[model samples]
Target: MRGNIIVRIEHDCQDLPPERRSDLVTRRLRFLSDAEILDLASRRERQYPGRNLHPVSITLPADVLERLQRLQGSRWSVSALIDRILTDSGKA
Candidate 1:
């Protein structure tokens, strides 16, 4: 199996516009080769054994997170809450 493709950077260096304040923000993008892309995909298959790949990002509700934090205070902490729940469930 192969990993993600490795693209080469090839560009004739040039100066950016004066209006662009940050050098970091002003950057050029290079194209990736097909073979390199295939190699990368193959490598990924090997690295992640028997795993179905899926990309994901989650945004939680602010109030819910705040409530969770409130419950996670000094004495009755997050870990404690988890332990208590698990123990009460007779799983631990």
Candidate 2:
């Protein structure tokens, strides 16, 4: 039961001064235990594989960039979108 609902995090807070270290460590641990963190981590692991892909550079109009950044929220990167377009267009 504890395994599902509780998360244990081990950190070395030794460098932090004794007066504030425990509070800092507690906050950090609470952040780790958050549902949002777990969900994001799990989603990221499933989405990306553990290999480096070659990088390609592309330029975008400022308006285009702004629009895409707005539409896709935080999931869109200009480079990724350019690569996706190039691939779909049989140019990659």
Candidate 3:
């Protein structure tokens, strides 16, 4: 998988725009050969085990979310807030 590696996932992302829920973006894409695809998968398995495979989700009242966002301002993201709560309560 040494020289077999060509375009990387990071490099692929670099050709695109930063992601935003409110904006549409396009990424430069290329067709990968089977060997390249296999290499990419293997590389990812080693590099980011369990990443995005399992995600936790929750639902809260719109007003509650809005209030929290206003209180925290730009200091915290909703994801970070949830992570902190879980950690603080030992649910993590």
- The C-alpha TM-scores of every prediction are 0.26, 0.36, 0.33
lDDT of 2 by residue, 1-92 (tens): 01111111122223434334323323333444334323332312225455345433223334333333442344433334333333333323
lDDT at residue 69 of model 2 (Cα atoms): 40
Q: Tell me the spans in candidate 1 whose CA falls farther than 4 Å from its real position.
A: 1-66
- The digit string of per-residue lDDT tens for model 1 on 17-86 reads 2223111111110122433322222322235465543221112234323433444333343332322322
Task: Score candidate 3 by lDDT.
Answer: 0.30
Whichever of 1 and 2 has more lDDT, that candidate is 2
lDDT of each: 0.26, 0.33, 0.30
After the best TM-score superposition of candidate 3, give how far the Cα of residue 61 lies from its true spot, in angstroms: 1.9
Of the candidates shown, which would achieve the greatest TM-score relative to the real structure?
A: 2
Worst 10 residues of 2 by lDDT: 1-10
Candidate 3: regions farther than 4 A off = 1-54, 71-74
- Full candidate order by TM-score, most accurate first: 2, 3, 1
TM-score of 1: 0.26
